[model samples]
Target: MTSKKSDLEAAIDAAARILDSATTIGTLGHIGPDGDAIGSSWGVALSAHKAGKTAVASFGEPFVIPRHFEFLNQEVVVPAKEFPEGLDVVVSCDSASAERLGSLAGAATSAKKIVVIDHHVTNTGFGDVAVVAADASSTAELAYRVLQRLGWPIDADVATCLWTGVVSDTGRFQYSNTSPETLRVAAELLEYGVASDVVGQELYERAPFGYFGVVSAVLGRAELDADLQLVSTALFQEDLDSADITYEETDGLIDLVRLADESDVALLMKSLEPGSVMASLRSRGTIDVAAIAREFGGGGHHNASGFSFDGVPEDALAAVKAELAKQRR
Candidate 1:
């Protein structure tokens, strides 16, 4: 019996056998299902299906990513609303806990085996077998590695998913996570036939009308507390309705702020519902925002974290400001 503490390379070999023998495999991504999460989930699902195994993706929540992601769906992802049964294995990607599994918890728990793969710093590895890499820029990177080990070449489609995961998590290779190894992995992915042009166009070149408005509004209203080395921005419910976007669209907004020469931390908040606002935090150097997020009922990596609450954008912004203020003093 292979112990759970086995290395990633060993785990991938073991996982391939488990996947090949499984009658059915269910793949899942974390809540909000951003580029990295969706890309990784789809990568594993597609690779498994191509290998003659039944595979499907679950949103793990009520979240719906950009319609552009329909490219990755390829008629395979089962809506979170639908419940499928008799799964031989559940492959959880980029998720630290089952709570992140949301609507599909029942199926995951009932599966004969659960394969956990992720790169989050806060991951607790709640699965029968875990394959995690703290040094990985994104789970898509891990998926790419796993598929290569399974003797599968990175087809154009797989390359697209890998690229999305890399661009999304690396803030388009701008974040500190984009190590030489990250670029090396990316370079190999391109060899597998990933198109960089299409990726750049969809993610960077084009944007909905309201996207510009929201971006403009956010920049105009964005505040910087240089003394505290923090920058913050917020949006209201009107902003959400004006543009057909999800949390994924706002994924790297914090990183945008962190790009500043002096900013050590970045904060982005948007109205979720009547009074609820969603918060995403990003850090550049040594500061940890995970503790800050947990103080408000959320959790994530040291430099990246999230939270939600009922309140006006400014009010919640004030609270976060106070939290950092305490740190400054």
Candidate 2:
């Protein structure tokens, strides 16, 4: 095995031991919990519970669980508004940087130990132990390995959570990041009776009616720069207000902007609160969007990455366009 893989295996072994010995474990997902974040966090929490350890799942910020992910709410997931006292260990799932952990960073500091489990290429490698497998398709995949290493039981609930994470991060196994190993893990998850059809229906086919209005407003204003081979769209607070949709409903809208095959880069800028904007970046070719995201204090996979800008939509778009132009030159 390569030295990098060897080191990761060692880290996983160490992490498993830490988790197994902990009497109370806490899992923190990124600030804005997506499918992978929620899935991996929930999966890890469930694994700890199955192993007879106390576990709690929380996200950095208060968020309305996206409609598709509501099924995961069958179990109580604590909000990070107040960090529980006396957490023996804290694990960060699917977050690349400490900043992305939001308020959970404080909780992590108070914990006796911290472990980071993630698949983002730009991960900062924080925490006392990091099971950062950039080659893995998702954090859920890494969590599966860790659970197996710890000899934790993978009940149907755990299987379903991990499977949701795997499916989402791999784009339903269609993203280029999907590998044979990912497929094998997914196959095993299915053996635990994961309902593939239900997952598909909830994640993809069950968007709310208001989401379509938001889509129309955003995509209707999409702009293409032929010379730069870039397609971009900007959504303002007014758009969300008019569409009667919340920021959570804006999930998956980037997929529409990325449909321009002729473009090398796809960009989406969405207004968040008053002075903040979220920039979603997608690349169709050799361009590494992760590099761009890192430049703006964020990180993710190469093909898909994102950053939050402390500015308005127009400024965020201009900044991204300039960066793209510089990268092209």
Candidate 3:
């Protein structure tokens, strides 16, 4: 008698079967396109192209790639409008839910087959074939496994993309999610000529000159909730304008805010626009920030998570504080 395949093995097989018969493939990441999103999407899209499939990678509107990820080959990625219709398969990388795809959610829904690859605990299992592993360090790690299962070649560029995802999502291997398997995957990708030093410098060490000013202003307004052991801050559009910094440049701000020795939880609220805010949450392992994020219709891992708010930053901050207070009690 044949044994039942593990979930991972089953997903890999299902995804490979669909991909094997596909002529056109579309790879998508979540809105705001973080490193894991970009890396995993491109890793699959590039491999698909190398395998003689018509492929493209894209995110939603405001289709901007962070400057740090400029090293990735831009040709494989197309703007949302240019993403072809009637794809044989659509692969979603790192997005926890279909809504997170923003405008491109329709494309995924309409695809002949949908393969969801993700590591977020909040993933909704929306795809037809989900390669979801909440315990995996990052979607990039899962993507690497899927590629290996398919016998797809991991060229230098592909390895670089996958490596970026693992590095960024693991907090340079310092985050609690970093597992032995995560390191094993990283080591294998490195063998394909991934320039780890260059990836590190681009992702962490460099930012535009204006970024420092923005960080200073945000840090200046940071607040601490001693009882809740939480540190929080807000960044407004004016703050970005004052420093000539783009919204994407603020991605690193949470890392700085979460450094407070007195706090186990950190929150950074950024104004996406008037009456709209995005809250980023981080934990030093004591609090389950992901649950807090899910309460606000968002999701993520235990240590890191985020959600969007349809109110001013002040209101959003108040709501998050109230939630944290509730969780603490």
Name the lDDT value of residue 248 in candidate 3. 80
| TM per prediction | 0.88, 0.96, 0.97
Worst 10 residues of 3 by lDDT: 1-10
Q: Which stretches in model 3 have alpha-carbon errors above 4 Å?
A: 1-5
Best by lDDT: 3
lDDT of each: 0.77, 0.86, 0.89
Pairs with backbone N, CA or C atoms under 3 Å apart (clashes), candidate 1: none
259, model 3: CA deviation in Å?
0.6
Task: Give the per-residue lDDT of model 3 (tens digit) for 232-309.
Answer: 999989888988878987789999999999999999999858889999999988788999899999998898999999
For candidate 3, give the lDDT of residue 75.
71
Candidate 1 lands at a TM-score of 0.88
